[model samples]
Target: MNSSALVKHISECFIKPQYEVEEANKPVYLAPMDLVMLSVHYIQKGLLFTKPPSNSDDQISFSTPEFLESLKESLSHTLVYFYPLAGQLATQVDEARQESLVFVDCNKGPGARLVHATIDMTVSDILTPRHVPAVVQSFFDHDRAVNHDGHHMSLLTIQVTELLDGVFIGCSMNHALGDGTSYWNFWNVWSEIHMAKNRTDLVIPSSHLPIHNRWFPDGHDAPILLPFTRHDQFVSRYEAPPLAERIFHFSPESMSRLKSKANKDHQKIYTDSKRMISSFQALSALCWRSIIRAIRLPDDQVTNCRLAANNRHRLDPPLPENYFGNCINAITTTTTVSELHEHSLGWAASMLHQSVANHTNKALQDFLKRWLKSPFVYQIHQLFDSNSVMMGSSPRFDMYGNEFGLGKPVAVRSGYAHKFTGKVTSYQGYEGGGSVDLEICLPPHAMEALESDEEFMGAVSLPLTGY
Candidate 1:
């Protein structure tokens, strides 16, 4: 099909629901940390799966009406435990205190939205490796999936699009309501519920239930008083030209080689008790160095690598395994362009390792305390700066294991388009092995340079014909 025709086909394809489906429970209030995320966009996650074989005895059939019904029912039941997802964000101003507070209003009626769409395409059309497919873009209803000004914010929106030989389930949730860990926990529990659907003997264990109590240091209000600003204002200060997005797959062997190379390079400089370099650190360092080289930054220019680190285990008293909410902080390391381009991969990796190691429990507590005083001091917008790169998400989240009884996902992605130039998201390869898939967005010229960079190419596996 031609480009316009393909657009028309996707636009004409789906059936909208007649009414909204909400939680089958009551209302709840927002926690302190939840309010901190009120201005960001929704977190979009998509799972693509091929149809189950005809002879299969799985309770949920792929793309069938029975399947959709079971999904909605399971989601409803899942919300009973995760009630905040079914609620809406409500804001109230305290005139006496001269401040505004946002909370989840559970009684606001219509629950989370579930959009059912059908596309006249197959799974392979969009699962192409090394490229972000347009078909994948059509899987989610971007208009309704993201929150906007003046609209009543629904905490969760799910879109299930049926393909000719597969299905795409796209879920968009308000970031203010939860972090990556909480987000995956909700989906895992939903899948568990769907899998346990007609089996009375099967029970979802307590381990899966999300812990809603938001952890906070003593002496903090529900809406912590922090100097804040709108997301647009925050990003406008450092915005750069729009960037192109691409996916790069690194095999387990390649990652091992990269780690080994990085460690060896570190050994050449000074062998103080061998500093352990993790796969993530090695890969991140390599990407950071490659980006600087690709962009051809001036030798004297200063550059920074910012990584999103989960503080669940770094808090004073580590949080619960299932603690539900934003419990992450950005750890950043700044170095000159000369050092990144002139040094070996190990030098960059050591910098990342040290930056990450600085995140102790006291540091996290201090970060929270500082944020309470200066709420608008987040560094995410700095990613758009020409001299900075921000790495977000982890490949270890088990995204491929989100099986809703329709078999495992053939691929998964963060459905929303990343606008920042230096934004990079990493995920485990679809097979659940040690391989990593990097979703990177850079300016057009930078992308071209990265594509041709010899060092970067050495670690990336070329895309197969079918994939």
Candidate 2:
């Protein structure tokens, strides 16, 4: 095996939809809410599968020629349901108003991208380390490009990397195209299609079809115009400081205990079962407190933890659970370090719970309406500060169920897309059943400080190893 080169690219090809896209669906209007994320990095995510048995008389492994063909063909069929993925971003610049508009041009014959690559390392080489190695990022090539760059590049890119002993299927999805739920939905359908092997008679059922209609505020229309004419005005690009990314595994018991402690002290506050503290809120609060303590932010200064809230269910008459595209709203909670020191764990967790619970349907509408009036793209620095924690991703996503001929995934990992100092992502642990893998990025000193904190480290399990 060549150690000098970690990842070797084998081939690259564009996969178009299996059938012709309807002319009516050729263009997808960019909603005001979707444009806010146009400049953010594409979501870099992938999974690791167990070692494949050598070529045998009967078994067809994931890397087998027959299986690879099925996988590619399955993707083509999956694209018909998710037609916007097989397109490029289009910009409408208005010189008169100094505003630029972004939308999806889905008619381009060249659809989504698929890359075939190989790595010299084994599964052990990746999962053995306490902190995941940086080479894991090599499985993806478009991490550095923002979603706005999708105008020329494919809106969705998939890279399949064959390891010395295992395989990794990495996906780089444009943030504007979909959120985590939509992303996993596409993969799940693709895997379903691949289960038939070479069969072409299967088709996505109408019930499973994704709703592409962009959500809009009342009295507002699509193609939400941006205030700036150029990408440079809003897209944030700067040299980030050195950082360490680590994943902390938490068992169901630990998560439950955290939730219990948080809810114990908040009974008098909530008094309602519907407003009970959740494992997510408790765990997130724990991370936020530990990071602030590790970084030693001034007690007098204010701090914040911004959470990604899915609004599909929060709307009046609630959008369909399968509603595709970005319907994510953020909940930012501010507090002082001294207040955190004086409060119990439950108190901090309650702040998070309340922040989310308080975001009513009217609030969701108001937030979007305000953004529609004064549109601005999300900037990197806003969430990149070491003093704050920006938590995205969710433990509810079926990360372990993405099967494509191979067995269940051994672990789930993300690439270097949104790896800022305080960025955090939570994945459903491979063991399943309420287990969670908490991935966080921080400076080296702060990471070390966190690992040493007895109160925080006590609830976390050891690093992941191939089972």
Candidate 3:
């Protein structure tokens, strides 16, 4: 759609009545996962042939304020639809507590290149697969880009691109918007409803998980469950240029071999939940170590890496699927740069596994619940350690199957990272079954090191069994 039409469409969307919460007086609580908004950042780009578009008049374009208001309208709908969820989470997040508002900024300088719209990133990098071909190329170049920080406030931005045609659309959703699965479901449904002009029949189906928070007295006060503050320590303002993305495909056969080689009894394990994180853990450790070594940082410099974990399953009562916001935390494991240089894949994988296992215990969960309710949260934000690299698996994004009846996503990608949080990586199920695709953003040197590492290359050859 052209910028003008998109603006009108947005204004019309906002004309609809806002939804009211059943209980307006309840305290707005923040979910553990909501903290991502504070750390989330965005970078987008558009690619074109040398000739560019001959149809100059038909190219995507947007005036700054028009684009911002357009985003404001869409977000308003999102806020109203998920009001209760936001209201509850708001009690915890600073931005959400202020009201369900989305923030917008205009990017007019070279520094603005840090974050790009989702559509621009995907289209410019990954090839659009036929199965998920609904590439909304026009949207990214024309619509406003929104970034949500930890405070749960959306920072909306608009970039005037030189693109003569096509489109780019992207948004950095707070982790609180549910996992990639939940977000896509909500997005698909929202788009359907919006496009249909009020057709409720197109709404997405929900499995309906339980919707209340549980305070497990039994799970509190565990020594290993220490709270680390991410707020003050991790600032989420500046944008960085899009780090080059390297996609690696894994085959099932290689994965089986790796698992067999690592297993004690020579038994084969073939489950997605158990092995996904473990495999990635091994790979990530290897990757992290290799990068550190290549950089030639002092051996004494610690290289701590973390895996983000969703506490929904670990909780006594699982959070509702539609909670619509961040609801997870991380499992941090530290290693001396020297230690990783000498360890084998099995050893690193074990470290990663144990770190996660340690957190899954009752003590961690209990401590987390109590910690959230206590005043310690203020103190924790003061401790942002610089030695860590954070990576998470987003294998839950079923891009190809997220068919909106217009074909599936031609390409799927998670957004960018802020300056403070360190490196971030997200893995997704590729077009081929058993094949996986990975998106990574790290310091430029780290990317170069991975490209030259032989061991990392071996791991990349591993098989993709299934999602």
Candidate 4:
């Protein structure tokens, strides 16, 4: 790759204060409560790949100074980079402190540092999967878990490693920075600008999904709030809920049968042109049951499951396709462990359909609107205190085909590492057409039980989509 062709610039930015403060007085950027949890698997495999880049040529490099300057300029224009600090006690201190962003110059340090490695390339590529696996492995080997308290932010570990065909780039981000989609949008925009490419064709404008400035439970109408100190107090009790994932490739015969059954269930005519009763929902029910049985939950125990719904279309101001950042919220529903385990596949799918519909209904939307306006939100901290599970699926995995033209991703999985409670499961399109890959992370014991369940495996005819 030509040095001149390297579109994105690299800047090793570190957050060092111009004036030092006492350790106790320093402003904490990452609050203890806001850090999203990651499963043990995610912590173990902290570094992993996203959708593969277009270039298979892996000789790693860094972005130029010009690129870094441009990215900094771009970031300065965006509100997503800034977060609101709650409480009047911290307000004055936060205002006086420097903005969280900083740039570290790695080229200097003089004298003895002459033989040091200097990576060159654009910052956008820094978010790519190339070098992440090794960086994660290094963190694992050294036993450096993310700091539970202090300045919370994402970290990129770009290194020259022989394991990743010599040059690989990896990054670990604070879940608070943004959801996966938002981060990807940021990277794609950075890449286009760095390469001096025409972004008009590739970049989606901001008008689509406007960033929300209000606190999550904004105003007097806000629906839920049980404010507390300490992150563990807020999230620790939520139990690991049940979830399942897979891609079902329907044959013509199977499709006909499904359509016929769906029509009979609805007592209405159906057309093949439009999909009916999302197949994803059907599959999820199956997977959830397997998970439930494996866990051996009590028959009457109510298990809550939710599908994270994007508000791109639902919001009064519809979020644009490329409006990047977290623009979605989840619609939660509950069912008994026994109910799920004993139900037929279709029954499971029906419940999922109704649950999602109920939550997304106009009444629900009205409730949320009123809730967001309220002074206090319902304090349902108990929801987080119990063992819970959340399963999510989106057709957005089609974005994995974003190869810059290299090829679609062979596999795509969400990165998670919540030490305490909650488990997440996701499915992404696989490299092979007509197939999708799945990844799940949970407690060590939970993972072990599922892996060993013969009955569960036999029922779904589980396919091995290796991690």
lDDT of 3 by residue, 205-301 (tens): 5542223332223433211111332334434344444344444555555455454444422123322234433555555565566556555667788
TM for candidate 2 is 0.94
Q: Model 3 segments beyond 4 Å from truth?
A: 1-27, 31-81, 84-167, 175-185, 188-198, 202-204, 208-245, 251-258, 264-277, 369-387, 419-422, 461-467
Candidates by lDDT, descending order: 2, 1, 3, 4
Candidates in order have lDDT scores of 0.70, 0.82, 0.43, 0.37
In candidate 2, stretches whose alpha carbon ends up further than 4 angstroms from where it belongs are 1-5, 23-25, 55-64, 197-199, 203-207, 268-274, 463-466
Over 4 Å off, model 4: 1-162, 166-177, 190-275, 361-388, 393-395, 402-409, 413-416, 419-422, 432-434, 443-449, 452-467
**Per-residue accuracy of model 1 over 265-285 as CA lDDT, tens digit each:** 888876874678898899999
| Alpha-carbon shift of residue 261 in model 4 (angstroms) | 8.2
Which candidate leads in lDDT?
Answer: 2
lDDT of 4 by residue, 195-294 (tens): 4454324444554233423223224331123233333432222223333322222333333444345434433332332335664564455456656665
Top TM-score model: 2
Q: Which pairs of residues collide in candidate 1?
A: 22-111
Show model 1 residue runs off by greater than 4 Å: 1-33, 56-63, 142-151, 197-201, 221-242, 377-384, 462-467
Q: Count the backbone clashes (under 3 Å) in each candidate.
A: 1, 0, 55, 59
